[model samples]
Target: MKQMLAWQDISRQGAHQGIARMHKAHRDLLDTIELAGRVRSEHPQISCRDIHYAARGQMPRGRDWTEQLLLSCGFRVKTPPRSFTVAGQGVCANLIEGMSITGANQLWQTDITYVWAGRRWYYVSFVVDVYTRRILASHCSRDLSSASQIRCLSGALSRVAGQDLSGLIVHTDRGIQYTSGEYKRYLESHGLRHSMARYAWQNAYCERVNRTIKEGYLQHYTTDSYSSLAAGVCRAVRLYNHSKPHRGLPCRLSPDQFVKELNQGLHPDYRVNIWSKLTSTKMLYVN
Candidate 1:
């Protein structure tokens, strides 16, 4: 009775676009997101500060309050809050900037991105082959934990039965999941040379793939359930790897076709390494 009396003055706003409109009694989650949606669509790289700067007077509340609301709406500022830490010798020095990653299994870049399905948020982590531009593997989980990353890598490795991975390198940002003791041990056990990017741009390949998967594919199938979203990601990946022809590939072959032709020696320019030319023209920031 006391709890009921305490909330008697508050009001419940009905749902909007399948989401309940949050207000003072709730924290303005929906309205803040609605404004943020427009800002994000215009500028995917926009930060929380930028959003606040753009929508100054119209914000639901103060900076922190509005930021929290935006976060709940799956809007992460481009600037990650965590400070970079070096493991062993140095992470920045081990970066792939100058390395000759010419083969499919030679270099694998990894990153995690948040996807919204209805009110719930899902973390989708993927590993991309730097050479072939193939999505080697991906794992979708509720939380962005190291376990999920490990699962993704494990699955990728299992599928590399006869592939030459002796010079394998795993590149990722300095997130806790990527830097944890367990993750480091896994890398050491697999004899994988791990590299960490000091700046976000250094890990561009995987970030670009994440954006492509989201905007190019997943955005169209925006549904209210996780299962539907997961299936959509799988279907999209298949289409991307098998059907979508890339201008970079010989005769504009899809990623899977590019690798298949190279294996069969049907690709005329198989000796040419395309790493230098394979970069996302547009800047990609983690959302």
Candidate 2:
């Protein structure tokens, strides 16, 4: 009768294949564990429990192995730290609580964010006209340099050529891309006014646009097998700007719809003014 031996007690002659297989299994497991760590590091808000659940079908793994591998790879299983994020403050403070937009192309808000496709990262820069809530232009690239932002801004300017901007107030966060001297000089030459969000909320409008791209388009359109990050992002942006509804607008119109309305001069009774409502309530209370 043959006796069963513990894994550690296996001899080199008989255990070669089994040992090789076991080592390969451990390597794959460790690779997955390392990936989870990377994900956690990149998105610090993700929890161990979230990783465990996400790894289920993905890794053919059990919770205990997942936990042990994570621990062995120097990952601590922990609840994420509480986050203290607010929308408006710092460089974005002055831009929130209903910044008024008097005319088309008068105000543009811009921001940059990252997207992942397959295994690589990409960047998307957006320019949204505030008054009309229209996405003037968005560009996606493999790099997050100031050049990407400038390219997107240039595209937006080209898209709006011949459009008058007597009182334009272009707003953005204090991201280095927006604050670069090159970007500043470009805006100055175009005769556009600059306004930065004193608080994050000052950039809320742009942030919402970002949320739509990330949560709506990216989450739905992308999969693990995306051919390229740029392709995925470009497709996502095209879907969003042309098809998706804008919640900020009545009738749930898309940016394209809003632009159509603007070009037709169709919004005769539309409540374009934001300050009058606040002023009317104050007058009633005073009376």
* Cα-based lDDT for every prediction: 0.71, 0.65
RMSD of 2: 15.2
The per-prediction tally of clashing pairs is: 0, 15
Best by TM-score: 1
Model 1 root mean square deviation, Cα atoms = 17.0
Q: Alpha carbon lDDT of residue 132, candidate 2?
A: 69
| Candidate 1: tens digits of C-alpha lDDT, residues 13-93 | 322322443335355565677777775654455556556655666777777877766776677744333323232322334
CA RMSD, predictions in order: 17.0, 15.2
Q: Name the lDDT value of residue 137 in candidate 2.
A: 85
Q: Which clashing pairs does model 1 show?
A: none
lDDT by residue (1-287, candidate 2, tens digit) is: 12445545656565778878899898878677766865554333334544564334465466677767766766663432221232332332233234445567767888887667668766777898776677788887777677888899889989888878776777887766666777778888888777776445557677777766665456555445434555656766665566455556656566677678767887655544433334545532322
Runs of candidate 2 with Cα error greater than 4 angstroms are 1-98, 223-227, 271-287
